[model samples]
Target: MNAPPEDDLSLGQPNVPATYFKDQRVTCEKDLYKSLPPLINGKAGYQSLLPDHTLVDTSNHADPNSEKGAKIRPDLGHYEHGVVSEEHPTMLDLIILAYEVKKARKEDIVNDTMKCTKPLPHDDCQAPYENTCQTSTITRGQLANYATQICRRQHRTHFYMVFIFHPFIRFIRWDRAGAIVTKRINYVEDCTPLVRFLYLFGRLDRAGKGFDPTVQPASQAEAEEAKKYLKRWEPKLERTVFKMDVPAANGKMRQFLVWGSLADPESPLGRTTRGYPAVEVIDGVVSAKPVFLKEQWRSVAVRPEVETLKELNEHGVLHVPTLLCGGDLPGQETKTHEISIGNWRVGHKRIDKRIHTRFVVAEVGQPLENFPSSKVMLGAIYNAFQGHDQAYNKCKIWHRDISGGNILILDNNKGLLSDWDLAREEADLDNGARAHERTGTWPFMSVGLLQQPNKQHTTRDDLESFFWVILYYGLHYLPHTHRDSLDHMMKEIFDQYDFAERDGMARGGNNKDALVRRGRYLGSRRSQQFSFIGCQPLTEFLFDCLDLLGKWDFRYDPTIQSWEEDGYIPASHAEMEPLWRQALQSPLWPVADRAVDQVRLSKRLDFIVRGERPERKGSKRSDPHDSIQDDEDDDDECSPRKRRKTCHGSEAAHL
Candidate 1:
């Protein structure tokens, strides 16, 4: 927690109020805020927010999976804390975008890594990229960390940042696409731009401040109704009691009193998804049945989740999450791409469009690990397989991202396939207008997909992913016979991902690929791979999976480009169906867990996405949370956490 006696930008009590600091010798960060004049509200047609002193502290809001917890603090933050807006019909607690500031010397912070010539060349900079500057690299990571924290707290289109390197100050705008940074402006020469920006920012309303206008604060009565449903929100997250208004063309508006989401993204970009426990409120009365509310920024290149769910539900697909209401947030497209930073070539190379989308489903359930017995686990997985097969064959919608996170267990112990946000329709895929894109959780992704970065998702891949999801669940919860270190064993067996230097793309599954192709479980220390204690049915079921699909020998033969080009088609859903069903009717039921551990199942999904073992005390490896590092790099460009910063962005010295 931050030590208080803090002053906010909107309203602060500075001891020495100085309007401009040009020639002043301000050495400390505290002095810079203590003496600077704030942008007091109602000054220029409504300059409400002011500048004050408060370190950008995010001690409480750690990634739930993180063991040591998130320990990050920027030099300063210009924010509105919490403002309740009564201007609209529904009282709204708008999603506020906080501006970050970092104190640094001229040598550390930069806009680009390469040196510019006197007369800029038409092609790339002739000088070698100054990529080895450690201070500059760490500063960029720090900025990313701050942006990630803010985005987790609120839904935003894009947010701004103030990067100061003493005499030189740079303005940066970050979004899902990437960051747009302005060239260095020597604040020592003139402070007008900085002052004008702060003053102008104060005059803007909630929407102008980058907060979602449609998300309003829930009234006292609505809050009470929500408490009856959800037990309690994440202690790390601020309890969000709010209303979501999804606009409809037929004059019918949708509203839900959302309590909290499943998990928050660790990074500022990508599909920042949250599964909310929500209840409908029509004509001021809360509905009896609670619903599952999903909010995410869908890539404009892909189809919307609402369309996929609606089509599947209409087609009578079984075991899929039932769709209720879903749509795109009106006029809520990402604005980072539209921004132009002259002379800075930051955000153009791969600027993918992202749209804010919301959808509601009638049913909600626990995750896969919540199952009490092996019987329930097998039954659930088999039924979920049924849903996947049905969707692929009947509705022609393939479940591309088949991870443990997407598998849900209903009140009746039946399995349901969730999170079709990444699903691709067969018709659309066959059309050939769209390019094949890689998607799925790393730990649970198919070996073939992981091995070949350019390969497209196939039903055979989904079947393998489903099997991996089951295996991952079993290893963590069920009793196992691997007598070695569990953490080390997991790290080696999962064979999650590691970045390749040539292209900066993630690669894994070499071990897993060898396992299936050669029929040997490859572990570094022990040859005795897996032996489930007291569960022969489960063990037999897993071993049988080796024979389910014939090996395609996806070895890269530099000669013929790719295996797909070599005319090798993936196995259909039907080919893997018989094995899944037979496992369900195994002679021995799925064994019940010997002892329930204290660890939660939801964090395990994070394990899959992070792709790194959860390092802790007594482990051979150094703990990751010891410093602020971006080990997260996704193959989809906007992949989940565990990356290296490689987006198309230029860096220049602020000085």
Candidate 2:
């Protein structure tokens, strides 16, 4: 058979051999023979390497008949011939083994080192962790000793920060209206840690709200539930209420209404729109001035004038009622009448009288006869001063308008210091430069305060007014002759002492006549005797109080120290001892008894130390029968002991 031509193959056709060709003889070619396809010696062409048929081996490879095959031996270390020997574990194996050894050794080394060396200072030292400790125990003890000094320094820095940055912060959020409504809950479990802590500690109730001091305890389950809720929302409702700045619609006017009745209903003097005269509550009860009205006189003149009166009242440090609400009196009117109770106005009416344009209604308080005894009054005053000091520390400005009319008597025989219309921010203390004239009631106004129209009013002026009020309360008369108006009083004070002089009266030369005249007026028979005249102990107490004020320099001395240091004593030593002793003496003592006894004891001590002994009219041996006569006269006076008995017994209970 002949192979097909390449071209024929390409065309996909078979080619016929040329052996039977009719027109041509066959030509023998050696090359052509050599080119013929070669035959296979062993197998056919294009055969697969796999055998076609299987060969049966009678001797199995595992049979003993086969030399190459032997019974399978369980030789663990058998070596095969011609096969590459598995060389005794390569360098990698030795390296891995070495690594294992090194790892074990490293662990051992670590363990040994740990054992050899001491534990870390934090662990070994039983004290606080040294690494994170801020101070050693010794250092902390030293710091404790100087805590006050450190606090003072820190406080100075804090004050600087507050003064400099607070205004800016305030401006940023000044317009923000605080939360309007709030709900109080005892405690909630979902509350934050702080809320939970507060609730757990009884600081907050079960609803996670601030705990009311008067509230009674709740059941355990309710408390637990409250804790759970407290965690959900930290109720700061009470705090928010206090922080909320309730907007005052009118510019500066605030109105108030005190609800209570004065002891003397006939004398409507102390009646205020918000207080006693308008409304009658039980005596000695905690009465509230529910209504409030405040008026900010728009005109600069009116405001300044009113502010002057307010400042004078403040200066005298008189107790005034809080201002609740006020505005321009109704009608296009220039005249109005407002009743002032204590310092607050209860009601305001537009009166027909031109001179008395504004009528403010104030609640009437107790009569002078029902007023707190001298000791109680003194204590209240002291408390007021302390409050003033606290206000100063807070950088709050207080313009106390102290005056005879502003003072009031409470059923409890205590005085409440009220009113804040004239009060300015501490930052406004230097605003005196804006005013053209003195801005306070004349009699209480300091000399400098009167002369320097723009001179900043300092706390010193307030102290001077306090002195005047104290004198008035003791003597039942003004230090100077009564002037018809505020202006007249101002003029008199200025004329008597040249305020322009740096030294005030001291530098201008002592006006002894003025002092003596004032003294005489107070001592004169024409002066009205207060109801407590027979109270010799009270009289002596008043004298001692006067002495404390007299020792101080009332003028605006630029070099004066803080009020606490130079002007007032923080602790009333004489008063405290007796009260403390009394408190310890009777644990089950009635509140009224305690209060009265404390007052009486304090007064008695005061009298013994300062009061003048009564003169014996006739030199006669003391008679037992005469003792009752002496007692009658003594009882007329304000005796601390009598006061105690009255207070502890039915007197307080009756109210």
Write model 1 residue lDDT over 1-655, tens digit each, in one string.
Answer: 1122234433432222332455567765554444332333333333333533212222123323222333344444443433322222111122233333344563444435553333222334444332337877777777887777566556666777777776667777777656777767766677666665565555466566666777887899887887676553322334667888864446566998876555545677766666676789888898868778888777787788889888899999999988877788877877655553223443223356678888788877776656778768877888888999899888888877776666777779898888787788877777763536677766677787787776766777788887787666777667666433455545655646778899867778876766666655523122436766777777767766655533334433346556577764446676667766776777766445532431323345446777856534321111111001012121122442332211111110000
Please tell me which predicted candidate would have the highest TM-score against the true structure: 1
Per lDDT, the best of the predicted structures is: 1
Model 1, C-alpha of 86: deviation from truth (Å): 26
Task: Locate the minimum summed-lDDT window of 10 residues in model 2.
Answer: 155-164
TM-score to true structure, per model: 0.78, 0.30
What is each predicted model's overall lDDT from 0 to 1?
Answer: 0.60, 0.27
Name model 2 segments beyond 4 Å from true: 1-372, 383-387, 431-436, 447-455, 477-551, 554-655
What is candidate 1's CA lDDT for residue 562?
Answer: 64
Model 1: worst 10 consecutive residues (lDDT sum): 646-655
lDDT of 2 by residue, 1-655 (tens): 1233445432321122222112322232222112111210112242211122111111112212111111221101111122212332111101100000010111111011112123222122222211133333433222222221111111010000000010011000000011011111111111222122211222212212111111123334433433332222222111010100112335432221221111101111111011122211232232233222222212222233234333434554333443322233332121122211112211121122111112132322332222334445444454445445444444345544433223434555555443333344545545643333223433444444444444555665555554454443433321112322323332232224433355322112133223323332223223432223334444443334334433443343457677567764432234323432332243332222111222223335555777955343221111101000110111111111111111011111111
